[model samples]
Target: MKRIFKLRSELVFSAAISAIIAIIFAIILKEFILGSFLNNSKNTTEYVHDDVIAAIEYQLKNMNINDSNKVQKYMDKENSMLYLISIVHKDGKVIASNNKEIKSIDANEVVDGKKTFKFLNDNRKNLVKITRCDYLKDGCYLYYIYVGYGKLENENIVGIMTGIIFIIIFFLIIWKRISYISEIKSTVRSIAKGNLYERVPLKYKNELRELSEDINYMTSEMEKEDKKRSEFLTNISHDLRTPLTTILGYINMIKNGKYVSKDELNSYVDIMNKKSLYLKNILDDFFQYSKLSSKDIVLEKQKIELNELARQIVQEEEDEFIKNNLTLSINLMQEFIYIYVDPNLFLRAVNNLLSNALKYSKHNTSVEFNISKEKYNNKFYAIISASNIPEEPITDDEIENFFERLYKKDLSRQKEGSGLGLSIVKDIIKLHSGFVKTYKENNRLFFKIYMDIKF
Candidate 1:
């Protein structure tokens, strides 16, 4: 609600500023430009007035009443706009007027001093100036000067109407924007309270639309992460309980003296030890995953030969493959290819991949480890892949989920190992600014890593 009020306040402020500027501009235009034009018009009408008055005076002195045509002709020429002249007697009788509509002059209106009055004629308001001619001392001559000011009045009406229209338009824009921002505020509040499904309505274009899209994207990613975290808890609990239950059961059996022979007792101890070791491995992987997921992780990176690294990791894992009844093969590029990486973390990622191969490979199947150079977009990268035939065929979707935390293949959940191996590998590779992928070709499931090669 406060946000909405703030928006409204800002809009009102802007409108107020605009209105002030418009009013100032109107004042400047009226006082400087329009005032100058009106002044010139008044001056020109005054010149015409003096000339008409001089002609009437000259005629009254020299010509007779029958010779009033000369005065009427002069008045006719001047009466074309805003000038009406008349010759009136003291008894309210008009001898000649340029306007034929003036049948008689009002004797009461014939005053001594110059006086201004409003005159209405032909649906227009005019200013009238009354003058009594002093040349005829018997109060014989009087003139009415009319100047039409209706155009100026119309201009004032237009300016007022324009100001009213501007005010209405500004308010309409403010109302629309306030309504839109209110919608966004409401939706954001709902999302803050954990309603990630709420999304802002996409109205309008450009900047507002992009903001809505970004908010929706952020909410969607948060929802996915929430779901993954829930699943990680559930799966870790189940995996940890399995090994713990096995070790406890063996220990209880030995405590009750249930073994029939001494060899059987030794066998129980061996199985318990193996189960304990499995639990330790799971705990270790969990710790590593936790450390890698933290934001403050630091890496000590150094340049290392990629081919030599792969060969060494594979050789270390060769005996484990043989013990699992699997054959191991290694093919490395003869030319040396070096990449910058943290040796410990990179070794952990490679070890996890090889261990995963041993756990899932079909009996007596050949596990292939290789390092080769590849080019993409004019940049060289070293490709390290470990491939083997799985005991069960893995689908494309399952392959994609392999790098997600606590995700395990349904076929291999009964196998002995933590499901975090591939996830940890993914995290380690991300720290090195590289990527990992899995694909199956020719019945061999392949896990590949791509690292940028720098000289």
Candidate 2:
């Protein structure tokens, strides 16, 4: 047996099925009504024919056998009274028929002690009535009275069957509609219960499909915003703690008068200044991150030669590199690699990368800049990479989390700088429709930036 449908709260699947069943029942009822009407018509026609034949037989009994004009007048009058009636004789001859189509009746076929009565043809194509009577006083003379109406066709049956089939088809359609609605409701309920990934299994591009797609899109957006907010809170808490610790340390030093000598006092003041600057940077990073989250930052995009930009940033940081006794090297191809970007923001991002490299790199290790172009998917990309040998080998997991805001692998090195440098770099790259990633290979920390030239 086929599975029957189930009802659900959200969808009207069962109601739709019931509606279809009702329609089918109504169609069947209509067919039955028409069948009843046809059957009544057939019965009435048979009754009228029987009555006409009986009346003709009574008139014949009262008439004189020798009077031919009286018998003819009675037959003609009976024929005029019923249009479908016909009379036939015992010798297989049609004597008087209102319709010329009817043939003679056989009087040997008896029904209820009568030699002839009403009957249906072999194919039920015609209705017939037969009667037997003695016109003369002697029993040797026999006369057959044959009366026939018209045939009852099967057109009514055909119409009823058609109505039944239509009702079944209509019910099937309603059942399917109800099933679809139930599925939609089930999916919606699942989504309402915090199942952000829930979706309706819709196959067609109809109104239901569009509605399901819109709901899925909305859930995805809400999940993304929720994730960003959680990450923002975690990053803010971690980043703010480092600066506060440094500031508290400096204030403790001043309160204790630990810097008695002039040189010691100057060093303490320098430490305070650095700590204050670090706090200011952290505040700035927070503002920038908020702006990015709110979609407030706009890119001032323009074509820029990456080689020239790298060289200029490198030159600007030459003093710091030297002061830290770091060796820096630049490898640039002769061909100009141009990319559309916000120059100022791009410079800041590059500066952040270089600063990170300088701060984390072991003293006297070579920091290398390699600029090149990569072709992929029939599109050109400008790649700027910076790498330096770290004091210790960084782990793969650390590299994966390098761009996460305020994430630090070495907790002891927190005093060196604010931890939002790589986060800012990531935001800037995203703004340019580009990407940034970090990796550790051969005891060297590598940061690669990719910018699409085609966009």
Candidate 3:
């Protein structure tokens, strides 16, 4: 039964059932009020009839039928004493009545040896009481009365009915609102279960609308992340296979003695050695990234001058820079800029940055560096920035993701990198409580490092 209906429809139906039950209860209550009013009216009519009978019996004992003055006094007293009453003659004529139209008694029927009381207004169908009485000697004198009372009034019963109908309409509106929310929740659940395209209908401007928009945003982000993961796996597999294939091909050639010349054999052995080192580098990157991800790398902190550290890293890479025909520039603050950091990890970060600059920069292009101080909110920061002229400028978006594990900006340049150097640099900086960012300006890639000087 639950599966037979859509979630939205099921919610509406349940609400409708609740509304129907409430309406039924309300109707029953209205009927109960009407019934109670009818009963009270009957009681009032009986009490008034008894009073009239006692008055008539007293009049018969104390006054003659011809005494007009005495009868007029009695009529005034009865009018003041009863809720609603009337007197009529057997000739179908009215003598006195609380309501004028009720004065005429129908002669065709009799009740207790008197003419029957009939309702003068045909519209008042639920009149609860009608009583008749005889007082005169010829059975010509009759007392007639009718009374009605209830929660309903002639004018306001329409209003009451209108209110009841409005209640029903309000229930339906609530049901519809709830059903819409239910549908949205169901759609979100479906999306969470791997239906990437599942979406809620934008039917109204309410919480549900905002919720649907949030879900759509989340799903889009998830899809992007999934695509990145897939690409990362494919890139890793390719990197691994290329080195293994080279090593295997070279070993088979050596085993079959395909290189007859001593120089050719040495060259082949060198090639094999380079390919093995490349494979080892890739594996090492994977291990390092995995360790950083799990937060297993611990840092031993020490106070050191950042400018000195930068000079040392540049000196270490001087030979490689010269071999590659790349120009290295170093800028250091005149005063010592001291910071607390792990020296080895900090050097690794600076080294990785310099290595990346070397790998991406064009031959004979100068890589520039600036070591300076930036102040914000009365706090001083040691800022290290490096810029290199690359063969092609990287996009702003790609630069922001430079430190993501196994992320390569240009797949065609896969041979130049293991895609983990920048990631390691980022992790090391984070361990030192520093921040790093990259940007591209005027066809030159810029890397910025920020570290607190005071702490």
Candidate 4:
């Protein structure tokens, strides 16, 4: 059931199986051929030479072979189209023959009473073999057998068997590949039909395994994105509806004449205005974040002094920090670090960090804004960091997903503003080819943006 094996091993296995089947087939066919030849002749020797040699050796043990005519007559009697029989006399004279092509043979070349020789017959070489026999007083009854056709036929049989082996291996491998490809196509089709959980079977340990794993990873990511999109729509709708409901309720109170004093009516109007502004802020953050998150988000990048930009942002938001009873401190390095960035997007990213710090920091505590050039992994980066002590303690898990869209750490979910500010900051920084990270040290949370300054 575990179908994981190397391609090389599979091919070897196919070849092994093909060889076994071909060998069996060759043996069966050889027997059938020898059977047909034997059945055509009148000789009844039972042992079948299912090989290249269809020999019929004559045993003249008691018969007198000194009569050349008698030997010739006997040779002529046993001659068949399947094989030729000739008697080689001791004096190297080929006395009797069925074919007149061979005139004589060297007696010394007949070693141990058997020899294989080649001669030109019809402009082609024909192999002839002498079968083993005894030396008589007149001459030895050498069975000069023409074995060319039998040998060629045997070789052809072997060639046919080898061809069959390769053909079987080719088709077996091709069929497996086609079946696996079909399975992959089917799984992909299912995934395309919104079955994001469907996966290819990983029963094979081959190149396809890597491909399957990659596709499975892609589908998992798409599933996560789909779930996240659904959640985003639900949360945004709720956030939008909450403020609209409050504003509508205030208008209804005024319409129904529920308020007795003008001051109370004015108070309702102020609250409505504040809710409407908060709603607008939420919508703006959502749209901006969505735009930056899109693939088409383009940045108009230019070289600027990063330290100067940090100072300008701090100065712009200094009044807000003071009004919120928080001290804003700037710590910039002496050297002016310059980096390529989209100025508006970069400012937005820095403003979100400052806003988050202002929103969370304990009153009367100082928010530290630092800008410096740093070297990490042999690359120079411009680092902008802000550190502040939060009004409420935060856990490591909360900080881990701090930049995720609509992920609010406030357990009561009563916090003002949509939770997309930090997420937008992350997207803007990414568009500029930078990264943001937040960590806690000395009981103060630190949010840092690292942008490559070397370029």
Candidate number with greatest lDDT? 1
TM-score of 2: 0.57
TM-score of each: 0.66, 0.57, 0.65, 0.68
Per-residue lDDT of model 4, residues 1-455, tens digit only: 54566777776787777677777776777667545543432221111222322333434434466666776676666656655555667656776666657677667644444434332253232232323333434545555454433233444665687677667765775587668879999999999999988988874677678678888899998898888788778777888899899999999999999999999999999999999998988888977987876789778888999778877888899999999999999998888788888888888889989999988899999999999877777987899999999999989999998998777777466777688889998888888788988999978999999998844
- Deviation in Å, model 2, residue 301 alpha carbon: 3.8
> Clashes in model 4: which pairs?
none
RMSD of 3: 10.4
Q: Alpha-carbon error at 389 in model 4, in Å?
A: 2.6
| Model 4 Cα shift for residue 394 (angstroms) | 3.6
Please give the lDDT score for candidate 1.
0.76
Report the candidate with higher TM-score, 1 versus 4.
Answer: 4
Tens digits of per-residue lDDT for model 2, 294-327: 7778788889888898888778888888899998
Q: Ten-residue segment with the worst summed lDDT in candidate 3?
A: 110-119
Give the better candidate number (2 or 3) by TM-score: 3
Judged by TM-score, which candidate is best? 4
lDDT of 1 at 270: 93
Better of 1 and 2 by TM-score: 1
Per-candidate local distance difference test = 0.76, 0.67, 0.70, 0.74
Candidate 1, residue 101: lDDT:
77
lDDT of 3 at 360: 83
